[model samples]
Target: MKHQATPYFTFNGNAGEALDYYKQIFHGEVINLQTFGEADFETPEEMDQRVMHAQFKKDALFFMVSDSFTDQNVKTGSNIALVLECESTDEIQTYYDRLKNDGNVLMELQDTFWGATYAKVKDPYGITWDLNYTKEQ
Candidate 1:
């Protein structure tokens, strides 16, 4: 199975601004940018313009960023996480189980609205990981 890790940044707001700045500096292409307003479910009017997810790639490196949910707390120093993109469901479960052994499982593995199996875990060393497995198109 393939495993790729990308840096994920959580922003209280201004994710789009940050992505734009990074793109300017890194000269990368924005692969995807989705706003909360475009989601299938309903979102507050104020949050409609907030970024739900975004990704950019520069050479061999990929970066992701998103605005935090209204109910969530996101701080600057601790706002970064490692996102693991797994190739298969088995890889997702295996990594989740192993990493969550003595760590905190913030979000249990489940199907997401974006059609992916996803989970969030804080490993024993206090590093957070977001695991995801997307089915082939």
Candidate 2:
């Protein structure tokens, strides 16, 4: 299966500003910008304006950014993660199994409201990973 890695940045609560800053600096298009309030998922009232997810794309350079959930805190050293987009369910499972072998499972691999099989894990070396496989319609 084809696998692609994208850098994901997590901010405490200034994801929108970060996204805007990156767009301005890179002259890239910020697409798929969604706020916690915009999504159908449940969130605290205070998190309504927080960025749930957003992407910045300029030519071949692409990455994602989002605000941490209300219950979580984002610190500088642990704010970045690698998003592995897999091509199939098995592919995701395979990688998840390998990565979580001696790692911590931040989020168990499961189906998400956004129509994808997703999970988050921190490898033994402390590098976080976001594994996802979007099912076909």
lDDT values for all models = 0.89, 0.91
lDDT, residue 17, candidate 2: 89
lDDT of 1 by residue, 31-70 (tens): 7789999987899988899999999899997888999977
Model 2, span 50-135: residue lDDT tens? 99999999999999999999577788989999998899998899999998899999999999989999999999999999998999
Error of 1 at 41 (Å): 2.5
Write out the backbone clash pairs for model 1. Answer: none
Which candidate wins on TM-score? 2
RMSD values for the candidates in order, in angstroms, are 1.6, 1.3
lDDT of 2 at 78: 90
Q: Pairing residues by index, what is the TM-score of model 2?
A: 0.94
